[model samples]
Target: MMPSATRTDARESGVIGLGFATLWRGIREQPRLFALAASGACLYTLTGVASSIVLGEATERIVLPAVRDGHADWPAVAVAAAVIVGVGALRALGMFVRRLAGGTVVFRVQGHYRHRVTRQYLRLPLSWHQRHSTGTLLSNANADVEAAWNPLMPLPFAVGALIMLVTALALLFATDPVLALIGLVVFPTFGWVNLWYGRRVWPLYAGVQRLRGEVSAVAHESFDGALVVKALGREEEETDRFRVHAEELRDAMIRAGRLRGLFDPLMESLPNLGILLVLIVGAVRIRSGAIDVGQLVRVAYLFTLLAFPLRAFGWVFGDLPRAVVGYQRVEAVLTAPSEEPQGTRNLTGPGPAALRLAAVSYAYPDASPDGTAALPGTAAPAGTASPDGASQDDAAGPSARSERPVLSEVSVEVAPGSIVAITGRTGAGKSTLAGMLARLVDPTDGAVLLDGVDLRDLAPGEVSRAVALVPQQAFLFDDTVRANITLGLDVSTEAVWAALRSAQADRFVAALPAGLDTHVGERGTSLSGGQRQRVCLARALVRAPRLLVLDDATASVDPRVEGAILAGLRENAGASTVVVVAQRRSTIALADEVVHLDAGRVIGCGRHVDLLASSPRYAALLTAYEQAARAAGTDAMPDPDLATEAVS
Candidate 1:
C-alpha cells in the first residue's frame, strides 16, 4: 500500500521550495531565454508606472491651466499625448519580447524534460517499469511535465509585477506620503491574503493533478482492452469505472475553483479599496491645499494599474504548489535508476549462442521468499489473455500479484543449434525461464550466459543482436507488413521473403490488397490471431537471431500450420538455438530435449518420450494435456493450468 494524504502533507511544506528549485535549474540550463523574458517583463511593467507619471504631468501642466483659463492648451496637450503614445509603444515592444521569450522558456523546458523522461523510460529495466501504471508513466512524461512548467508562462510577469509594485510604491511616496502609506498597508494585506489562499488551495491542486493521471490510466486501460471489455459485456462496468475517476477529477478541480472564487475577489478588492481610500482622503487634502488633484490622481491611477500585478502574484502563489507536485512526479522518472551498469566484457566467438542458466532463481520483486505472490490487482503480463486474477502481474504495479516465487533455483543448459522446450502447467514459470535465457530479465540468485559470457557482463546490444523472445501474445504496430517485419531495418527484400516463408506468412502477405504494404492496424487488428502470431515470428526470424525464445508464440496458428512452422524452426535451429515454451504434445515431441517444471522448479529435463516413460508426474501431466486436447479437438493445444483429468 502507498502513503496516505496525512503522510503526503509532511512533504507539502517544501512545495514552494521545490517549485523554485525547478525554476532555478531551468534558468541555469537556459539562461539566455529567461533573461530576455525578464528584461521584457521589467520593461513593460516599469512603463506601466511611467504611464501613470506621464498622466500626472499632463494633468498638472495642461489640464489644470486649461480649466483655469477656460481655454485648451493645444500645444501642451499634443506634447503630452505624444509622450503617452511613446510610453505605450515601449510597453507594446516589451510585451512582444516577453511573450516570445517566455513561450520559448516554457516549451524548451517541457521538451527537454519530456525527452529525458522518454529516454529514461527506454533505458530503465523492465522490472523498474513494471512497478508503475502505463497511464501514470504517460502522465509523467506528458501531463505532469506540462503541469510542472505551466507556471513558467506567468513567472517572469509575476517577477516583473514585484518590481512594478516596488517602483510604484516609491513613486507614490514621492508624490504623496499619506497615499504611499495606504499602499504599504494594502499590498502586505494582498500578500497575506494570497498566502492564506495558497495554503487552502495547495492540497486541492495536488489532488486534481494526481487524479488526472488516474483518469489517464483508466482510460488507457479501457481502450487497450476494448476487445476484452466488449467481448465480456463489460462496457458498462468500464464506463462506470471511468466515470468514477472522471468525477473525482471534476470534483477536485471544483474544489480548487471554489477556493479561487473567494481568493480572487479578495485580491481584486484590495487594490480597488486602496484607490477608493486615496480618493476620499485626497479630496480633503485638496481642500487644505496640502496636495493637489494631479498628485492624488497619480496615486489612485497607480493603485488601479497595480490590480493586474497583484493578480499575477496571486496566480503564482496559487499555482506553485501544483507545479511542485507535478515536478516531483516527473523528477521521479527522470532520476529513476537506469539499466543496471553495463559491462565492458564482450561475447566470445558466437554462432548459435549456447545458453546456460546455472541455478537461476527469480522472485517477482515483492513475491514471498518461497515464490508465492499475493498482490490483488496486478495487470497480467501482456501476452496473456485475461488476468485470471493472477497477482504476479502486479509486478507491473507489481504488489498486485499473489504470493509465490515465479521461479526457484532452476538450472538448465542448451547446446548451440539445438531445440529445447520449456513445459509446465500454467504457473510453472515457463515464460519466466525463457525470459532469462534471452536476458529479458536477470536471475535473482544465479546467472544466464550466452556463449559462456554472463549476459549481464556482455556489452549492451550484444545480447539483443543474438537473442529474440516471441511471447504467446503477438503485438504489431500500425504499419505495413514489410515495415512491421523489418522494423526499420535495411534488410534485403530476399532476406525478408525467406523469413516470411519460414513463418508461413508469405502466402497470406502476398495476397493482401497491397501485399507487404498493407497497413496492419493497431496491434495487428486487421489480421487474424494466427496471422498476427506468424507475422510476429517473421519479425524475429528476419533478424536471424543466434538464439530465439518462443514463449508459445504459435498458439493461435492451426496445428497443421504449427507443425510446418516447427519443422522450419528445427531447420533454422541448425544455425540458431531455439527455446519454445510449449503445451502441445506435438510441439514437445519435436524438441530434442524438454525441461519440465512444477511449481517453480525444473522437475524433469530430457526427451519428451523419455520424460513420459520415466517420470509419472510428467506422464500424468502430458496425459491430462492429451485429454484436454481431445476435448478441445484442437490437436493438443493443452491448457498449461488445466486440472489433471486423466487418472494415472
Candidate 2:
C-alpha cells in the first residue's frame, strides 16, 4: 500500500514545478494504476469531443434540413442515435475501469504506509518510544493515511480536463484564432490564481493536521484514564478541556472551508468570462461570415461542459498545498533513523544464561544545552570532562558538576542459575540497569554479556528469546487469556496451563466462565490488578526464558499472592537466572543475593542477611521497607522459613 514516488515539496521549485514532479513520481510508482486512470480519462475526453462534433454536424445537416424539408431521412436518424448510444456505452466502461483502478491504488497505498510505519516503530530505540504517544502514532497510521487519498482522487479528472482544453482550443483556432486566444487566456490566469491560493492554504492545512494529532492524543489519554477521572469526579473539568480543543479544531476547519467556498465559485465564474469574451468576438465573426452557426453553437456547448472541469481544477489547486504537507509528515516518520541499530548476529549456544555488566555508563542527549554538562547525578566528576568539555555522561546543569553519578564505571555479575534481587530508592537507575540488560538501549561505554557474548552481537529475536521482561505496568492484548499467555508460541494447551500454574494465575483463570478462553479486554481492563499481574507473569513464564527480569512487576498483588508466585517460580524454574528489581523487603530477602543500589552505584552485593550485617545502606533499605509495610499493614511477616528457603 505504499506509493513508490513521493509528492515534491513546492517551496524550492515553485508550486507548479514541485506539484507536477510529485504527481509524476506518484504515478511512476504505480504505473498500472496511473495507466488505467489515464486511459479512462482519454476516453472521457474523446467522448466529449466526439459528442461536440456530432451534435454540431447534426445541427447543420439534419435540424436545418428538417425545418425546411418537413421530413427526415429515417435511416440517417437511426444511425446517428445508435452512434451516440455506442459512444456513451464506451464512456461508461471507461468510468467503471477507472473506479476499480483508483480504489485499488488508494487501498494499496494505505496498506504499504501502515506496514512501513509499524516496521519503523519496531526498529526504533526505547528512548524514542518514551517520547511518543499512542494516539499520535495511531492517527498517523489510520487517519492521515486515509486523508492523503482526497488530493489524489481528482488527479485523473484534471488530466482529462487538460486534454479537453487542448482539443477545444484547436477547434476554436480553426473557427477563429482570436476566439481561441481568448479561451487560452484563462489557462495562465488559472495558474496564477492557483499559485496565490496554494501559498495561503498549505500553512492552514498543516496547522489543522497538527491540531488533529494533538486532539486525538488528548482523546486517547482521556479514554484510557476514564476510571481515574470518574474516581476523582473531574468529569466536568475534563469536558471543559475537551470542549476548548474541539472549538479550536472547529475554528481551524472553518477557516479552511471559508477559503474553499470563496475560491471555488470564483474559479467557476472565471471560465465563464472566457466564454463571454469568445461569444462577443464570435458574434462579429459570424456576421462577417468568418464562422457558421453550427461552429458557434459547438464552441458554446464546449465551454458549458468546461464549467464542471474548471471546478474540479480548482479543487486540485486548493488541496495540493495540504497534500504536500501531509506527504512530508508521513515521510518524516518513514525516514527517521531508528533509535537502535540492528545487530548482525545471534548467540549460538543453548544453556543457562549468565549476565555481566562491565564498567557501564549512559547519558541523555539533551541533559545539557551548552553541551558541557551532564544530567543530574549522571556526571563522572567535576573535572571529568571529555576533550570537548562534555562529560562522559550527561549532567543537568552548566558543567560536569553533578554530585553523584547516574551510572558509574561499575561492574557486576550474575552467575548461571541464580536469583539476584536489586533494591534502590526511587531514582537510583535500577530501571536503567535492567534496560541495558534487555538491550532496549545500548550502553554508552563498556558492555553487557549473556553467556560470554556481548549483547550487541546477538540478533534481536535471539535476545528476546533469551531474556524476558515484566515491567511495572503489564500490558495484555485484547484477546482470549490463552492467546495472551502463549502469545505467538505454538505451545500446547497443557504447556500453557502448566506455565499459568507456575505463575499462580491458573486458580483465577480456571474460575472464569471461559477458563483459558476468557477475553482479557483492552489491556486486560476486565481483570483486577492482581489478576492482570498474574497473567503477565504467566506470559513471561510461558516463554521459558533463560534470563527473566522483573522490574517491580508484582507491586499491585497482595502479599500472599506475591509470595505464592515467587514460591512457584522457585519450584518450577529452579535453574533459570532471575533478576528482580524490588521495593518490598520480603521479595528482596527471598533472593539468593541482594544488590543494594544508591545514586546509580552498587553499594552492596551479597546475601540479604550478610549485607544487612555488613552494609549500613542495606540495613537502612530493609528497615525502610519494613516500616512502610508495617505502616500500610499489607501483611504480617510470612513464615521466616519462606525467606530463608528463597535465599538458600
Candidate 3:
C-alpha cells in the first residue's frame, strides 16, 4: 500500500498538476510543433475579430451612408469585400494548420506515454503484476491515456476563444464603454455555469472511467475462461455478471449527460442575453448623441461575435476535470517502484555452475485487501482481505516485524555437475526453493549464491544465461515451434533439433506437417499437455544454461518419456548442474544425492538409500511416491527394497 501522505498527494496533485505535467511533456516532446499550433490558434482568433470589425465598419461607414447619399461608395464596398474574403481565407488556413499541428502533438504524446507504461510493466516484478489484472493494465495503456489527452483535442480552440474574447472586448469598450460593461457580464456568468457543471460532472466521469475498467476486467476473465464457462453451462451466469457492470456504466453516463443537458442551455443562453443587453444600452446611448448610429451597430456586432467563442469556453472547462482524473490514474502505474535493485556483475566461464542457498527464508508478500497476493494458480474471491488485513499479493515491507516464511532458515549447496533432487510433501517448500535457485524470487531472510557470488550481485542477463527454470506450467507464444524454441536466439536449426532430441520432443515435432515450422496456438493449446511440457523443456535446453532447475517440468509426461528425458540429461550432466523438484520415485532414482524437505525445513541430505535408512520422514515420503506411481499405472514402479539397495 502507498503511504497515506503519498496517496493524498496524488489525489490533490491530480486536480491540476497532472494535467499540466501532460502539457509540459507534450511541449517537451515537440516544442516547435506546439508553438506553431499556438500561433495558428492566435492567428485564427485575430482573423475572426477582424471579420467582426469589417462587418461593423461596412454597416456603419459604407452601406448606411450609401443608402442616405443615394449613391454607392464603390471603393469602400470593394475594400470591405476584399477584407472579408482575405480574413475568411486566412481563418480557414489557420484552422487547418492548428488542427494538423495539434493532432501531431496529441498523437505523439499518446504514443510516448503508452510506450512508457508498457516499459514500466515489463520492469515491474511478477509480484507487482499479480496485484493488477491484464484488463486493468490494458485499459491504463489505452482508454486512460485517451481520456487523459481528450482536453488536448479542443485545447487550441479554447486558446483561440480566449484571444478572441480579449480582442472583442477591447473593441467593444472602444465603441461604447456602457455597452462593454453589460457585455462583460457574460464572461463571468459563462465561467460560473462551467464551474457548476465541472463540479457536478467530474465525480460522475471518474466513476464512469472506473466502471469501464471493471467491465473490461470482467469481460476479459469471461473470454479467457470461455472453455470452462461453456463446459460447465455457466454462460448465463457470466452474462448476468457482465450485465451488472454494463448497467452501472450506463447509469453513470446518463447522470453525467443529465448534468450537461442542464448546463448547455444556460451556457448557450447567457451570451445571447448579453447580446440583448448590449443592444439595449447602445439604443439608449445613440438617442442621447453619446455615440453615433454606426458606432452603436459596431457594438452590437462585437457582442454577437462573442457568442461562438463563449461556447468554446464551456467545452474546455467541462472536459478539464475528466482529463485530470485520467492522467492521475495513469501516473499511478508509471510511478510504482520497481521490485528489486539491479546488479552490475556479469557471469563468466560458467560450466556446470555451482549453486548455494545460505540460511534462506521466504514468505509471500502480505495479501492486499483484494486478495492480490494469492499465489499463481490459486483463486481468491474478489474484495476479500486476509486475516491480517493485508492483500494476498502485498509485499511485506522491509520493516515488517513478523513473516510467515515459506522456507525458514534452510540451507543447501549443489556442486558443479551434480544432479540433486529436492523432495517434499505438498506446501513443503520444494517449488519455493527451486524459485530461489533460479532467481525468480529473492529470499526474505538470506542470500542465494552462484560460483561464490550472491545471485543478487549478478547482472540480470548474467542470471538469465547462467540458469534456466522450467516451471510446472508451460507457456508458449502463438508462433512456430521453432520460433518458440529459439525465441529470437541466433541458434542454428541443428542446435534446435539437438535440444528437441534431448527433451524427447523431436520425434513428435518431426511428425507435424511443417515439422519445426508448425505453429503452436496460444499457450500451446493445440499441443497435448505432455507435448507442451516437452516443448518448454526444449526451450530451456536450447539456452544450454549452466544451471538447470526443473520444478516438476515433466509431470504431464508418461513415466517412460520422463525416464528417457532424465537419462538424456544425465548423459550430458558434465555440461550443466541439474536440480529437480520431484515427487516420483523414478525421477528420484537418477539423482546423485537427495535433499528431503518437510514443512519448510531440510530434514536430511544424502543418496536415496542413505536418506531412507536415516530419516523416517524421507522413507514415508518415498513410500508414498512409489504407491502413487503404482496407482497411476506407471509402466515401471520401483521395487521398495531394490530402490534402496540400488543407491547403496
The order of the candidates by lDDT, greatest first, is 1, 3, 2
TM-score of each: 0.91, 0.88, 0.87
In model 3, pairs of residues that clash are: 367-390, 367-391, 367-392, 368-391, 368-392, 372-393, 373-392, 373-393
Q: Given candidate 2, what's the lDDT at residue 218?
A: 68
Off by over 4 Å in 1: 1-14, 338-341, 367-403, 641-643, 646-648
Instruction: Looking at model 3, report the run of 10 residues with the lowest lDDT sum.
Output: 385-394
lDDT-wise, the better of 2 and 3 is: 3
- Model 2 root mean square deviation, Cα atoms: 6.9
Q: Put down candidate 3 lDDT per residue, 1-648, tens digits, no spaces.
A: 223553475467643454556656556877887777877887887888887778877888888888899999898788889989999999989888888998888898889889999998887765566566666777778888888876776677778878888888888778778788886677887876776676667677777777777787788889878999999999999999999989988998899889888888887898889878877877788889998877777677666667776776677667776776667667778888877667899877858988888999877666544443222111232433222222222223322314456678888889999999988766567777787787667788889989888988987678878898887778899999999999999999999999999999999999988999999888888899899999999999999999999988898888889999999898899989999987687898899999888767888988988888888878876776566556666644443334444433
Question: Can you tell me which runs of candidate 3 are displaced by over 4 Å?
Answer: 1-18, 65-79, 286-305, 369-403, 632-648
Ranking by TM-score: 1, 2, 3
CA lDDT of 374 in candidate 3?
Answer: 22
Candidate 1 lDDT by residue in tens digits, 1-648:
112542364366555666677677766766899889988999999999999999988888899999999999898888898999999999999889988999999999999999999998888776566555677778888888888888888888988888999899889888888878999999889877876775667677767777777788789889998989989999999899999989988998998999889987897898899989999989988999989878988888889889987888877777777776677677667777754667778766657878888888777655333321111111222332212112231122334334556778898999999999988776777777776766667777888888887888888888778898887778899999999999988999899999999999999999999998999998999999999999999999999888998988998999899999999888767778999988788888889999999888999999988998999988777778777777777664555455374333
- What Cα-based lDDT does every candidate model obtain? 0.79, 0.71, 0.77
- Name the TM-score of candidate 2: 0.88
